[model samples]
Target: MLTLICQGSSFALHKMATGLRKGAKLNYKLMNEQGISLDTKDNSDNNDDQVAEDTRKDSVFSPVKSKAQKSNASSAEDDGKHSLPEEVDSDDQEIEKLQRELETLEKDEAKLKKIKQKEELRQKVVRKRDEVKALRDVRRVCIMGDSIIKHLPSIQGVSIFAFPGATIGKLSFLVDSRAVPLADFNFVIIHVGTNNIANGHSLQHMSSDFANLVASIRKFNKDIAIIVSSILPRPVDHSHTKSTVQQFNFHSQDYLASELNFKFIRSYRPFCFRGDIKRFLFAKRDGGLHLNSEGSNRLRFFFLRVISTLT
Candidate 1:
């Protein structure tokens, strides 16, 4: 019985030792698997931290980059609006200068045109002078006055120097200026003073101016026969009445004719019918101021008859 007990104890001790070894191996394997799992979890945590940091960085800088781009665009637009290229600016300045030059040229051209017209008028007056000088008749007659004398035909050996609005005051200047050549003419017929009356000059002033004009004609030649024609009546417009014209004629015949020894022609009688001026004797458009064809013929015949008697 003691031998059997000793064998059984040895077997039990052996089994126990084997069981402890197996438990140690199982614990060691579990520890190794847990260590590997812990390591993988740590690596995943690190990767997640890196990704979040990258996202934060992007969020912070994106608005700043976009603002910088907008600022650049606005600056470019401002440059386009406020400033032009150098070449284009220079061309605009040149165009403005050319427009100014063209305006100046137009003003100069207008002035030149007026000057040319004035020169042409002066040349025409000079040509009239030349024509008058070409006539060399010694027994020449000259009629000088306003438009009434201008209507006188260009008779042989006669010079009619008449201005439309000539007054008695202007007659002396007309004669002195060689407008009426008094040197070669033997007879001078004057029919002015109508314009003087129309211009509101007093009768006394008109008579005085007439006397001075007569004196100027006498100065040219003492032998020259000066005939002072009466002022014709205007039946129309009534600016000058028949009485006023008669008064001026009476003054010329009574005072100037005797004083200056000049002939006074009563030219108003032929146009009068029963102490009134005949309307038919004057032009229809003239308002009874100027003569018609019949009146002009009568005047021409009277002048010829008077001129024939002078020689």
Candidate 2:
């Protein structure tokens, strides 16, 4: 009876060991499915507590996920390393485009400013030209001569510079001494050379002296209009005969009009009748060498006509 009971107890103990071994394997498989790792400890005393804590953490974390999700996450990280963010790239492009546009606007603004300046300058120049034209339209006139012109009536808007027995050679001296303000007048009517002819000057000498006098006056004002009056005919008893005076007048008028660009007035023709001096045209006290009031009035009418055209 004693042997039989001992054998029964041994069989029960073996069955319990087998059941425990199977339970351990089932727990291990469950842990592996949850992605939990179990480290086998050499110390058997804390092994149960360590395994239970690991199992609780794995259940809470739910660590085991799909392989496709993990692969997608890794691919996204790799793409991020190689490429820029869409919003960031777009912002950079927009900034660059704005900068380029600003640069273009600046260039256009600069060009517009330059164009505006040029237009303003052109307008200023045009205004200046107009002012100059208006100023030249109304000219100041001066009549300069010898004793013959000195006896004439005073004219309006005409400055007279007369010296008796004054030759063409002395005219420049008067101008240099500032006795004649050449700058004050635009039109100059000169009646000299008659005295120069009377003083025994040759035609060539008188012409040269007259030209020099005109040139000196022009030097004072380049734009001055010079009108040279012809020497009038004198009586036979005078220093110069009518023929000699006519010859001098012709040569002087031709040279003044053609070469020197001066306007020559033919005042001598009106005072002469058929190559002879008109006694009525001469001053009664001057031996028919100087003009009378009648002659001066007639010459004044001619001078008025000449002056009217200039303005």
Candidate 3:
């Protein structure tokens, strides 16, 4: 009985050992199928974590990439901020250059205009000088005035240019227009200012007009003998007119005193008897504004005597 019991115990121990080995094998197979090995799972988990970390780093607003991109963006922004003003400054400099060029052009144009005007005036002066030098006749006389000198008898060498209601201004225009015809005469008698005195022109203005008229005549013929006839006396009742005429004549005589070949004749004195006008010397038909036949004859003789002296 003791031998049998020992054999059974050994068999039992052997079966138990076989069962433990089978259980270990089953566990190994389950581990292989379910992928539950520690080393392999740990390695796979590490790789997945690294991949997730890489994905998070590459995300749209990730801080790591955001910082680096922001740094790059900030550098670009700084460059733009610095360059913007430079572009604007360059544009402004270009505009300023254009403006300076335009101003220079305008100034040049103005200078050219002024130079052209000066040249034109110089040419006009030369032309007038040439016209004066071209005149040949010394005996031909021109008697130009208002209506007062219109009725003078025709003389051999005298040409009459009578303008009714003509003032000093009108005579200036007439002289300029008739410059060609007047160039023939060397003796010019200006019988004007009677109408100016009658029209009550200021003494200062009349004096200036007379000077301008004589200057105009001299421009046409510088060597011509110019005679400015005095304003004739009017009626005794016309006291203001007579006084103005006397003042005008006195001023003209003084003004023409230094002028070469210029004569201011006091023709009014011949018709005035001691500051009173001789009524017979003036036309009774026209309120003594004009001279009658006898007065005209006497004025012709007086002018003839002056002409003879010039010849």
- For candidate 3, lDDT tens digit of each residue in 1-311? 99999999999999999999999889988998998774778899999999998789878767766467779999999999999999999999999999999999999999999999999999999998887665553478889998888888877778888898999877988887863366777788888887888788999888778778877887887878788888787773367786788777887888654553478777766687877777897898888878888888878888887778876
Each prediction's TM-score versus the true structure: 0.53, 0.55, 0.54
For candidate 1, write residues 34-55 as lDDT tens digits: 8734456788999999887666
The positional error of residue 54 in candidate 3, measured at the CA in angstroms, is 99
Better TM-score candidate (1, 2): 2
Better of 1 and 2 by lDDT: 2
lDDT for residue 219 in candidate 2, whole number 0-100: 84
Considering only N, C-alpha and C atoms within 3 Å, which residue pairs clash in candidate 2?
none
Clashes of each: 0, 0, 0
Highest lDDT: give the candidate number. 3
- Candidate 1 error regions (>4 Å): 1-138, 238-240
Models, CA RMSD each: 18.3, 12.8, 17.9
